[model samples]
Target: MSTSLPSAEPTPSPSRPALRKILHIAFWGVDAQTLARDIQAHALTQPGWTERLHITAHDLPHADCLEAMQTWLTSELQTSGTRPHLSLLVPSGAAQNANAGELQLRNALISAGVSFQVLYGATSEERIRNTTNAIALTAKAILPSSERACFVVSDIAKPINPRMRSWNCEKCSDPECEHRLFTGLLPA
Candidate 1:
């Protein structure tokens, strides 16, 4: 009798899909105080969302911008009677190693007694998209689906090059850009 050959075992594949990073954005108007008040009021009268508000400002440089963000948090404290948890995501600057800036943002939040998280080195166009995606996913977990979200697209002046021109220009010509899909997803 001939000996039979042994069979090889099959390798198993991953059970779940890898999670994509999406930006969870909360858009506030120019008036942070008003926006904060409205959000806090909702938390007080309504039970759908946490009084906690998360903010992500892309490429912001002004003291006023910081103030506005702070205003939003302060309003939540005054109206809802508690400080909201905070997280910040910042893009890497020209130097590529922009973790310093991200640290500054985190430190600012900590100084204010707010818990925060910061993401850095997202300077490239591709990286920016990834970081934003990460934010979206994070926001979805904390906020409700019905909540309106917003993001600030800062200066496109820096990293001025042919490649960037192509990227931005493609958005105008291409219909598949995330901006288009994101806006379309919003309920009227």
Candidate 2:
């Protein structure tokens, strides 16, 4: 009998790493941060999630304090080239003066030109919809406008006031603008 030749396997080729989209979510409170960590841990342990989009996750851990979160948010806003997407996970009030924490969060975010809304739902679909919307909102997608109109300003110009010390504003908005011209708001 003739000896059969052993089959050869093709060598693997090097390829570029898979692109990953980082969704940086800033927790509004300690409880929220803890819950997020727990969720991440559980998801990683679950086989189903491991098979999904998430492979590995890493971020600078918040120092179990609100100051850390605020600082991180501020720093990211200052440096992130593209419009930074902020996902604020606000937890229910457990402490007696939880409102204080809420207020601090609001102050930090608002001062940085970030707007937010609280979402609560009774059903999974509702929750998902709310969450999708919240993310979209954070990304500055103009949706659910009271006037139900969409506007795009192809020509954007910087207006200068020669009279009053050359008024300078980081951003400008005009709700009355019928065209709904995008006035440097919600770039994300």
Candidate 3:
């Protein structure tokens, strides 16, 4: 009689798909300390968010913003242990094609195996409103159908005024209100 070999059991695959994590990182033209403080404040307000969500706030020097961003992103990917989606919030004006900085950033991210999207909006009220719309649309377009969230990296120094916040808001009745007149534009 010939000896028979023992049968091996098949390895089981994952039953459910993993939840998609989105990390929004904002790069403000502020000091690193201030950025860290702001991020901490946000984290404190939202309980358990820091653990579950991937929100990051950082400073980006105007001189070499793209290089800085690329380096930071690569570092984050290596350290975070999660392949969360990425979105960059840069001033609309700073995204000019003269230097091709945005293009370089995009290429770097792709080569590093990171999925990313770039959304631009002026700090001004009108432009910010448009940017919000763009952000939403882009999120819908780029995010996979599975569970996902958006992370925003921006240079928004202060909260936007209520009337000017929403894109559909009617013109402010009080013309004298400085907030109403303020466009929230950041320095180029």
Candidate 4:
């Protein structure tokens, strides 16, 4: 007698594929859109899924991003007449641990009662792409699909490109180096 191992996720039925709506808050602009699209496209190519990604709004601030977010939210409520329930899949590509900006964004959202979840990040080039895959993997662990959701790449996200680098991490010791801000490994 051969014992078969159980399948990880129930094999999605072809007849009834999962349908989901994704409103992308593209704080990272084209970068975020690319990541979101990659994630959604991969999901669609998988066994079962049908999704629509609508780039919802672009109001990220260079200085204070969450302030723009709050204003946008208020305006949206006023226009739509109903608060859109959001299951935000926020994928941030940052190497270091949460800093003040990141914390502030989370805190403001918490105060506003906006639902969200943040994804992990790493150093060097392709940080955004790696984070995208990581987000998809973790998300699959929770549920294969959802009824409604949002893909949010935080405005605080700094794209890492090591190709044209001038500053050396070893030579630089400034704790607040702009180079190290987004892609440096935090000290233990």
Candidate 5:
């Protein structure tokens, strides 16, 4: 009897490394530092989040917020930076407006060369509550249950002058100590 030819073994292909997962949270009319602190204090306190998840907070400009976001995304892409999933917090209003804003923002990001998937529309709320429920819900989608976090954004009244400068009595009388602006008050 003739010997049968030996069967060839199947070769396995090399597996690709998994991409790093990141979450980016952007807030309008909220201080970046406060948001970051709240997220860390409220959300990251969970167990698994300390190791697997990473998050960043940004304070969006009231005007042209989308455009600024686009620029930021473009820079990150150009620099070969990791593109994290984005979430936006906006004021509560008609669903139509929210939808429109979402589309425009999505388009802006895509045009700016973002490669990662952008999920969910804007989360809206009229006022800050004890816990930012909407943000927590959104975070839960991508992060583990323990890592979901939220924030309460309180508005601060604008000072008489928002600008900053060194105080100089020669410039004007009654220099606004906070901003160093001359309030035009007559010298007492």
Candidate 6:
């Protein structure tokens, strides 16, 4: 008669919970309102894990876009009260089809001390290449098949200002620096 007892099976460990969800944002010089709407729409439309929506303004085009973004950021920052992980879609090159509005957006962001990472958008190839890694990290990467939510600031209404052309204008002045650089032109 065998006296040896059957070896006991080892207890299995519980699986770990999934990490915080991340949403991938691809900017093509889109304004903040449109971007926000797109992100919200994606959250509603896409099927998969749920994660909070956010944005990182990379090299953008247009002052208006920045302004709109600032409005969104102000709300988000106030609510969240901290820097959130985000990605920015920027033109691949200065000579590309990038708009002046996009350039203004980037410049304003830099001046405001906002931070973001650049994802190339010069060509389909480059945009694809830059986005691959970001998309992979997300639980669900989404894009509108026909109309992407991203819209250039130039497409939005501009904030009109009369003294934007004047360097001495308070609108153009920078409190942080002796020399005032054009933060961005008021919507116009």
Give all TM-scores, in the order shown. 0.29, 0.38, 0.36, 0.39, 0.35, 0.35
Clashes of each: 12, 1, 11, 0, 0, 13
Error of 5 at 95 (Å): 14
Best-fitting candidate, measured by TM-score? 4
Candidate 6 lDDT (Cα, 0 to 1): 0.39
Q: Write the residue-wise lDDT of candidate 3 on 54-88 in tens digits.
A: 44443332335656656766765555455544344
lDDT of 2: 0.38
Local distance difference test, per candidate? 0.37, 0.38, 0.42, 0.40, 0.39, 0.39
Candidate 5 to native Cα RMSD, angstroms: 19.2
Model 3 — which ten-residue stretch has the worst lDDT? Answer: 1-10
Over 57-142, each residue of candidate 4 has an lDDT whose tens digit, in order, gives 22222335667656644554355433323323333343243244555555555766765544333432254454444444434444
> Which candidate, 3 or 6, has the higher lDDT?
3
Error of 2 at 71 (Å): 6.6
Task: Kindly report which residue stretches of model 5 are placed more than 4 angstroms away from their true locations once superposed.
Answer: 1-29, 61-69, 76-80, 90-188
Summarize candidate 1's per-residue lDDT along 1-188 as a digit string, tens digits: 01111112233349844332132232211222232333334333323223223332223233334555455445434543334333433333332343443445444455667654433232344333443444445555665565424322133223211121123544555444555546756896
- The model with the greatest lDDT is 3
Write down the TM-score for model 2: 0.38
After the best TM-score superposition of candidate 2, give how far the Cα of residue 186 lies from its true spot, in angstroms.
Answer: 33
Candidate 5 TM-score, true structure as reference: 0.35
Off by over 4 Å in 3: 1-52, 58-72, 89-92, 96-101, 124-188
Q: What TM-score does candidate 3 get on C-alpha atoms?
A: 0.36
